[model samples]
Target chain A: MSLQRLAIAACLLPGLVACVNSTVDQMVFNTPGAGIGDASVVILGRRHASDYETEPEFIRCVGNHISSRDKSIGVVGEQEFLDALYPWFEPRTAPLRPADLERLLEHRDVARAFTTMQTRYMIWIDGSTVRNDSAGSMTCGIGPGGAGCFGFGTWSNDANYEATIWDFSKRAEVGRISTTASGQSYMPAVVVPIPIIAPVQGTACDSIGDQLLEFLSAEY
Target chain B: MSGSMTIGPDRWLAATLLVFLLAGCGTKQVLVQSEFPPPVMNKLPLTIGVWYDEEFANHEFFDEAAGRAETSWLVNTGQAQVQLWDTLLKGMFRDVVYMNGKPGPGQMNPVVDAVLLPAVDELQYAIPAHTNVKVYEIWMRYRLQLVTTGGAPIADWTMPAYGKTPTAFMQSDEGAVRLAAIVALRDAGAHFASTFTSIPDVAQWLASLPRAGDAARRRVQP
Candidate 1:
């Protein structure tokens, strides 16, 4: 009788199952449009070039220095470069037709999403991946009581952007924006440096909005 | 006369002692027993793994003519993952779910699998002694991709980690502390992957303990 009772209790249990929740936090975003008047410019988010990994972290880091006007301007340019690309989209008109393809490319929102502020433009961060391979290690200065401690030096502060966009009913692109930045706060070294500096990407949707502003400025 | 006085003093002393004894009682230790019990382990076994794909979402832009569309769309599995995963051993791991197919609406990007706790395999998790008030290590690998509803590949990318969990100190119960720590760590990792740091605080760790329904019934009958 006792053996039978034990078996019955075992069968009643819910069975062992562990469900771990996802830990990766994410945000959605869309790139906006940019250009001067009436040209109907759009700005889209695009990953840096495949070789973006080759970007110099130190140079990018130098650009993040708030005290250094040069660095600040450089970061602005990096953001601006990203802001210039138009968002990517697939055409809805089904069936293989040349007209559909032309219309797709000609779609004002779609066209504006990819073009830069001006026809003759440049991209400073042509390399893939924003910073150097060992970029994140500069948080601690040379030694204790160090003067002009450059923990999280130029290479330590770099930002990258990855985004997607979906068209809104209002003839605009709306989506989530996800942003991530790198700096001293991202470092794993001891002697946590103060006044952390880093690079960041906005949400996909918010970035789209920013891009829209850039595209409209360039086109109109 | 002296002998009588001594006897009288002895009698008086005995009377005082008797009165003091009558007024005395032992002090009590008032051990107010609590109602809760220590936490118990509910072991659960789970498996995890990765999915592979050929394209990522943006690949649609590679041929803008073929990629532009107006329909409300979700990315297919292949376009969904990162590239680091192309190299892991192909096997079913417990506790990890890689994004391998289309995501549901309102789902965030960089799709992830659900977490598996306790664990199916003994080799999957390790709990170091006093590592933290509630710290556990989980090891598993997965591939990521997105697939359309009709079974077409959409995007592809793979990420794989060896030996240790790709991300650590995840899903902690540190409340506001956890959020602040993540922000700080994100910045640190950006500058130097090696310098990213977080230390668990043991003093303030809290877990809700189990409580008994009937304390009076549990007391050992004397």
Candidate 2:
């Protein structure tokens, strides 16, 4: 019986590894100066293309995490940022280039609008985390009175994100934080299936948010 | 024999269940931060007024079928082109003074030596469906005109830029298009800058401008 248990444990080792294994890779660019005292920054998710449709959770998660972690720098909510940039959200227009930014700042109304927001910096988060390389499957069936799912399946997720920090005062990109996380997930079943889900998006948010705080804070 | 068979099925079911319980793991978002490169500066001390058509500047590309202006890649591309022109020109020129309107008579600023007007003639892309080895091609065309503040035409040229990128199984079509547009615009901008200085009309106009020292001396002595 002990030998049999050992064999079963060997069979399940890979799945166990899949459930617990996760890796985070990050790179930091220039850090914001410490002297900018009490100036607020807004975190925005780029809405171009299908980004708005796919990456809201990750965006919101990062924003929430950053706000919760750092007490010194104020965080602007996503809706407030959008409200300040109203009418500029038209999907047909191109992403603002550096020159367009200068032009925008020069415009009386637009300048006044941004000035009213009192945001010194803008952090644009772009990219997505998605499920990839899914293999194996489980089957579900319904009986006369009840239904249950039984089967085995496994999948992996890939998370890629880049946070670009734009200094509104300087009208330039001051820093960038980019990260990629990839890990495996599995679902196993006997009579009742047990799903071992990977918190890929959540992990990304935490990692990014922590690093962002480190990058923005004077201590780090 | 029946007991042995029942044991075999039971073991298999348990193994399957173990596997299911152990699976379903994924990576979360990780962030890596690094120092960004410093901004590049231009050597030439030239200040030009930049302007774009108001209608074109605010125009959004609308998708009639989707009934949404937001999904159109062309819109972003168009907007990106305007920004690209501004960025590239700023890097090439010492000062870029943005003007609200075309530099017509009395519309030009007295401080600027010349004015540059960039108008979008066409912005488009092609990505056909149901094809292997997906190819996205973005075409951008611009009408660039340079005129002196006094309304004398210096040079006028029509520039076209093209960007092409491939898509595989996992790549996003939107990302491919955006990248292609960026590539096309960068190419077009580089071509324009490299060729603009060589144009006879532009060369003559630039050559005619007084030297900085001469102007400074006059200012100081006067």
| Alpha carbon lDDT at B215, candidate 2 | 38
Query: Candidate 1: where is the Cα deviation over 4 Å?
Result: A1-35, A38-40, A47-129, A133-192, A195-220, B1-222
Candidate with top lDDT is: 2
Which consecutive 10 residues in model 1 chain A have the weakest lDDT in total? A86-95
- Each model's DockQ score: 0.01, 0.02
RMSD of each: 30.6, 16.0
Residues A133-213 of candidate 1: C-alpha lDDT, one tens digit per residue = 445345333323453333443333234443332332233333333333443223222343333323232122233234323
Q: What's each prediction's TM-score?
A: 0.19, 0.46
Model 1 interface CAPRI class: incorrect
Instruction: Choose the strongest candidate by TM-score.
Output: 2
Chain B alone, TM-score, model 1: 0.17
- lDDT tens digits, residues B169-220, model 2? 4666656666556545555665565456666676666667776423322221
Give me the displacement of residue B10 in model 1, in angstroms: 58
